[model samples]
Target: MSKLIFVNLPVADLPRSIAFYEGVGATKNPQFSDDTAACMVVSETIHVMLLTHAKYRQFTAKAIADARTTSEVLICVSEDSRESVDARVSAAVSAGGTADPTPTQDFGFMYGRSYEDPDGHIWEVMWMDMAAANEAMACEGAGQAA
Candidate 1:
């Protein structure tokens, strides 16, 4: 069986978080959700477990760092093309998430942008052209790529 990945994030409002996730294309999985927690399916293999601040306290004794005030994690997802990357970021912004201030990356073979959810968790959407990357590698000298 294929392995599944679950990213757990602490959210101030569970329902709001679920709505934000849904806006960005994730479907809520009621099977693994409850009043204090939500299971958001990002893809077939990726799921996000959104836990309320109080619910999160059960998993750790350390203080939860506010994602808005402090960097905790940058969750990245791959898209099929550059347009797809931009679309996701746009959807996120329209759903009340803030776009990352950093400029969008535009390498010849790769493109990426990021957005922060209402709870301040960053989500990066990236797309890589493998064929272009392979071609670039073929044309480049060893030192340049390194």
Candidate 2:
């Protein structure tokens, strides 16, 4: 069976967080959702659990790091193309997120941009050219490229 991933994040407000994620094209999984938490389906295998701070603490003994004050994690998603990355970031900005000033582009191999949500959660939108990466790997294997 394929492995499943559930990323649980603490949110100050569950409803607001759900609305923000919905704006970014994510659908809520009502089957696993409730007043304390909402399951956001990012993809078939990826699910984000936006749990209220009070409820989220019940799952872990460690204190929840305030995302607004510290960098606890950076969520990154791969896009099909660079334009898609840009579009996603733009949508994020329009939905009350802040886009990073500069985007990282490493030739034709990889490109990425970042946005921070209202609560300071970072989301990176990236595009990776697997064909270019494979070609570069081949050249490096031949001892000609870095």
Candidate 3:
């Protein structure tokens, strides 16, 4: 069986978070959702659990960090191409997210951009060509060793 990843995020507004995630291409899975939480499926193996602030407190005693003011985590996902990465960021912005909370990264082989959700959680979208990246790294290594 393939291992799946479920990224649990505390959201101030469950419905709004659901809409934002959906806007960025995640599908809501009603079977695992309720008024206090939502299951947003990003892919066959990636799932995002959006929990209301109150509902999230049930899992931990620590106070939830105000995502807008403090950085706790930066989540990243890969797209198939550079265009897709840009499209995802654009969608996020359209859905109330703030685009480019961080600087854009464009190494010839890899392209990436980030957006902050309404709750201020950052999600980075990136695309890379592994073959090209490996070739570049190998050449750099050889040059350094010379």
Which predicted model would earn the best lDDT?
A: 3
lDDT of 1: 0.92
**Per-residue lDDT of 9-89 in model 3, one digit per residue for the tens?**
999889899999999899999999999999999999999999999999999999999999999999999999999999999
Q: Count of backbone clashes for each model?
A: 0, 0, 0
Candidate that beats the other on TM-score, 2 or 3, i.e. the better one? 3
C-alpha root-mean-square deviation, candidate 1 = 1.8
- Candidate lDDT scores, in order, read 0.92, 0.85, 0.95
lDDT of 2 by residue, 21-76 (tens): 88787899999999999999988888989999998989999998877778898888
Query: In model 1, which runs have C-alpha deviations exceeding 4 angstroms?
Result: 141-146
With a 3 Å backbone cut-off (N, CA, C), the pairs that clash in candidate 1 are none
Question: Model 1: per-residue lDDT, tens digit, 17-82?
Answer: 999999999999999999999999999999999999999999999999998889888888999999
In order of appearance, the predictions have TM-scores of 0.93, 0.89, 0.97
**Which candidate wins on TM-score?**
3
Give me candidate 1's TM-score against the actual structure: 0.93
Q: What is the C-alpha RMSD of each candidate to the true structure, in Å?
A: 1.8, 2.2, 0.7
